[model samples]
Target chain A: MGMHLRACFALAVALGAANSAIAETRLDTDALQLEVLAGSCANCHGTDGRMVGAVPALAGRSAEQLEARLLAFKHEENTGATIMDRIAKGYTDEELATLADYFSHLPATAELTP
Target chain B: MSQPWNRLSRRQLLKGLGGASALPLLGAMPSLAIGGQHAGHVVVVGGGFGGATAAKYLKRANPAIKVTLVEPAEVFYTCPFSNLFLGGLRDMRSIAHNYDELRQRYGVDVIHALAEDIDADAHKVRLSTGDTLRYDRLVLSPGVDMRWDALDGYDEAAAEKAPHAWKAGHQTTLLKQQLEAMEDGGTFIIVAPDNPYRCPPGPYERAGMVAHYFKEHKPNSKVLILDAKDNFSKQGLFTAGWQRLYGDRIEWVGLSNDGRVTRVDADNLEVETEFGTRHRADVLNVIPPQKAGWIADRAGVTDSSGWVPVKPDTFESQQVSDIYVVGDATVAAPMPKSGFCANAQAKVVAAAIASSLEQQPAPTAYWANTCYSLVGPNYGISVAGVYRVTDGAIAEVPGAGGVSPADAPDTVRALEAEYAVGWYNAICQDTWGTQV
Candidate 1:
């Protein structure tokens, strides 16, 4: 049983190393985390932040612009909103920065088809 | 001219790669440790918001992970916008979506087969197609099933006669047909279930929508609600909307006033209340009490409440190893069983699963839920919250989210209605990998 456990542990270490190498060429851990975090916004902002209709789209805006808007909402400076003021208060400034950077880097489009 | 490669979305690139044909390569991967195995098999049951989002995010987090989704239906009808369909504000096709994008763009193997049985100990699932599948991890989002025995004389046959329309497909159409067939002064009755049911504000929304229909078409028609609970989600907003738009056309009876339905006589078109009072109606919609889908019970993951308990952070089953449950089937208290909540939970679980495959500790998980209910053609109300794991259970984050303010201006209400439409489109794109 000990021998089997040791073998499994060794294989796990090797696989982890290989994954780290592969992940370097792809999205790093921080970038991936930001991507997942931004998914919560998709329910209103559209997939990849390309919204239609009255809601403002989040993609392709400057990082500073996104950050400023988020901070305003967070600090309750942006009043007369329905759900955004409450939703923005949920995150810290650090998360807001990460989200701004992530969405800013995404391609901005006027509309997206299925 | 050719499109720039950088302009291609992640889903576009995936579909261009012919990923669906690569299923054999995925199935050939070696099955080793549960969370530590690279390119591990993750079988997701159901193709609704929860399971579809989980499958897509799991593949996005780790492209090598194999996700096979087991769902019997070829087309999915969302419960979110279904009330609008009943209200004649939308069509049935507007709410129906196919699984082609989930299969092609996300590399999810969409199998139109019922998951007949789950062998938790062996980590295998038997399908109605006589095939058995092995998985390193299983994500069950089978939603909910009606508790047929909860109400006397309410069964499958009864549902056919007096549709529940809870599952959001043919039953929705059936109920709409019944309403259309009613006389001008006919009575339309809705029997609401107890708490912890899927879409807490759904019954009230249906009532409002039905009232809207009656007000337009049958001016003398009346809509009656027989609720099993004294209070409900967004009660103030719903009642206010009913009073403003529906007037005396709509009425509600709470359980405290003997409104709880004891039995339903579908053939006679009558419902009996707790006080043995019988109310006959031209149209009866009996939404039976619910429990987690039968698959959860068969897998032995559910508690006595007919829902599966899970570790709040990872959504892993508390009773069974190597299995995760989300959506309506989960005991994720403080977080309603809503589509938005399920989508958020799926992302958290996806990240946790990805981290586990690398043998890393699960990361800090946060989730959110927003439910939008339309009261009239141009009016809407919403409830939202942010949640995190605290003291070993899910709890709402303080001062982070709230419902729509009561007695808002018509402009605000109208804007909310537009946002509701936007939310439906956006959520469909997020979950099904395309617009419905």
Candidate 2:
């Protein structure tokens, strides 16, 4: 009975490690794929991508806004941004280029409803 | 109205008029005047747990303000502990309350009229009887309203057939009839709605009690819960109780498990799922999603979300100052919309309205709530919390509240269930001025 309990504990630890590894692999990405992913994103964010509210549609964001957010996620400076980082984490350099191109192409809407 | 009777506190006078003989309090002229100053008048729109307690305590705190209560119902039949009645352990009459004691003992002006409108600027309320009442302050505690349009092929008309029965009255009686007449090898389907609805664990408890009735009477019937949400309020404890007591007779499906009920064809007594699956049952109980009572919307108090927004401490509307919304009508964040919470809020509103009437500072308010959901006979689970106003919203005091201990002994669990019934009776008695 003691041996059975020990084996079960060991199996649980192994499964935990495997799950972490799967999460790590998903975080590695190319920039070009990231850019391609931004097309569907424009549905929520207006052109020029300044978004609104907690679920803001990002349209007309400044170049600085994109760079600051990306760096914040990469360095873990903004810890509560797990969802955003998860979306951006897999991109390669070329994918990032494509993403920037897609968002930058939009026209910015000025008005917002309360 | 000739030489108004001498003023006395409700507790003292009511205790004096014991037994059922003093039930009709209409003739007793109890005035709220103190020190010969003209007293303010407080008008409460509904006589549920919230409005009743507020009226009861407001009179107790100050015999000065003339309190007038307007409720459409002659007697209130509470939704709480109706499950025990369903289980056949308690009688329906035990859940009914009379407002006569409230009128006679507390000297409350109990008017049985539907509130038609509120002219906030004039500080007056219009009733269905074409009569107008001027109020120093107004408290509205009309309980929940069902969203008949939320589901396709369902509305007030169709609900009469399948019966949501969410609110107790004729619908409750109809649902009870369906269960009683159901066959031994029948299927009972309960379609539960999404969040921000009344009685989170209510549908589950109802399922258990009905199952209990079936276990003894029908024996072969089963209950299937088609829930819109994946995780329920007390899932683990409910599952444990279902497994232990009811065996495999009960089943629950969450949203991810294709549990979302999309439509109901009341003609065929059939329910359709989002995946286009149809389920026909011997008894169909659709506890539809709800909103603030319809009057709130008609009065332009509720936002698009179908709930009224209020200043947390005062329970006064964010839109209008003179009007206060309590009970299930207001958006009380960090507090579940339960009868206990409604009672707590009514107390705060009562104090605020009373204080405002005297042109004095409204006292800082505090509230306490304990919600108990019974899973079976002598088996219960609960969540308790104490609340205070912070940052203009009601927030639960951290470290002051918690859910029932995860592993309570059976005896303790039974005690909690008993206490739950007792609490329900106490609250109903306190609010309506008569015990159910």
Candidate 3:
């Protein structure tokens, strides 16, 4: 999955947008999409956007600031980023906004420990 | 496999769920709070990534909904970082996780037993311990079992000789021992399976990791990949990484190149290719074709393909009701059967079940998969995608989730290697409530 991934990705976005319009009615498309999307970030950002170690905590962060950073990463402008930029590009602006708002509301707890 | 659950007598059925003996196992679950939101009980089979995540997320989604996780193991060893162990980057201790957090903190009843049977209609699951647990819903992350009889001369017996090590447990240790005992300059042959196997990038990453070991310990040793597939995920990145790190120490033989292994010999540690060519190995690792776990078949969720076909959004079994199948046992194409996908799918299934029990709207599902493979201990590559239920099946969101740039700097590869470990820790911690 080298250029093959990028090549297929460039073509699929159009079909995805077109299908979203039709799939939205049957699949609860617009409602609570952020729920699962935000949870997925827990793999790196920690559960509910809380961090356990060196990675920054997403919990209780400012929504506006978080969204701005996500947008920058998505746009490949986050100079200090690692895989976040790659992961961020997979999200839309609206999805990024929803994630930021969702995490911002989570109580900023201490670093997670098992 | 025998369908023992189907022959449950009328008396056993009555005793399994109705008898007073089952109440003790119920503990806090069967409270008669009828019409209350999230008052149902969930029985999750398997304690690996999917089942463990489902159990934890079920509790998180609704604390009132009782969750009983049925797993045979007390300590769960993860497949995600097992490769690092094989490469000598990490040890087995760092790959083990337990259910303490899920049980103590999340209030999940962790049952250490094999889930032997699933009477879907009766909403009952029979355990190997001769106990039957009743549930309002079931989540199965049972994972895959090797198709023991798929290849000729390759069965349970052959595995002991040339272990698959597909499931990260004792088999992992066995393979490591064989590798350690292998003579310098000996060949380590990895038999890669066909398409649609668990972790598409796994076999290649394994080749890279093993080559790393050979480079340091046995520079004269060769790592040969006899693949059933002609093309593979991240081929460019892996080939480049191999050349840069191990020179000509690693080699790949694609299916078209007569690399598809059709049989194996445990006594001699050898395998035969499709072209009737027999290749001897100092140590053989066969990642045989796989099917859904045995319990999935017993539950009647699997089709002729021996894999469960799940509804795209909720991962509900297309063939059965009240049971959701996740992880490697599922036919989730475009989204590879990696631990990341299972964890993501479990969240959606948990939300769907919680919403149904509480009479809420179905939550929209979005799945993201990022699979990282270590080329060398410090050299890593990845493929990622964002998916949703579109066109009535799970399809990747376009323009999102791509592989590492083919020409990325070595610094980027090294950094990705670090993030790969970070991703593993965060996900394992998030799922099992502990970072190993």
User: Which candidate gets the maximum TM-score versus the true structure?
Assistant: 1
Chain B TM-score per candidate, please: 0.92, 0.91, 0.91
Flag the better candidate by lDDT, 2 or 3. Answer: 3
List fnat, each candidate.
0.51, 0.00, 0.41
DockQ for candidate 1, please give it: 0.29
CA RMSD of each candidate after superposition: 7.4, 22.9, 10.4
Tens digits of lDDT, candidate 1, B389-421: 889889988988989989689888998998888
* Backbone collisions counted per model: 0, 33, 2
Docking level for model 3: incorrect
Candidate 2 lDDT, B1-436, residue by residue in tens:
0011332433224423432222233222222322323357789888887888788767655555678899998878878777777777677788888798788877788999999888888888899999999987888887899887899988888878788877776788888888898889999899999988877778888888988888889899999999899987778878888887899999998899889999998888899899977888888888888999977765667888999999886888888777888887788867878787787787678767766765655655656666777878888877666566777678876654556666667876786686566556455644664653
lDDT of 3 at B156: 90
Q: Write model 3 residue lDDT over B1-436, tens digit each, in one string.
A: 0111221122233333444332333332233233233358899999988999988777665555778999999988988878778888888989999999888777789999999999999999999999999989899998999998888889998899899989998999999999999999999999999977888998889899899999889989999999998999999999999999999999999999999999899899889999998899999999999999999999999999999999887899999998999999999998899999999999899888877775665577878888989999788788888887888989988777888889888898998897787788788887897644
The second chain of candidate 1 has a TM-score of 0.92
Please tell me which model should have the higher lDDT, number 1 or number 2: 1
Instruction: Work out the TM-score per prediction.
Output: 0.89, 0.73, 0.87
Error of 2 at A20 (Å): 74
Which rank order by lDDT, best down to worst? 1, 3, 2
Local distance difference test, per candidate? 0.81, 0.68, 0.80
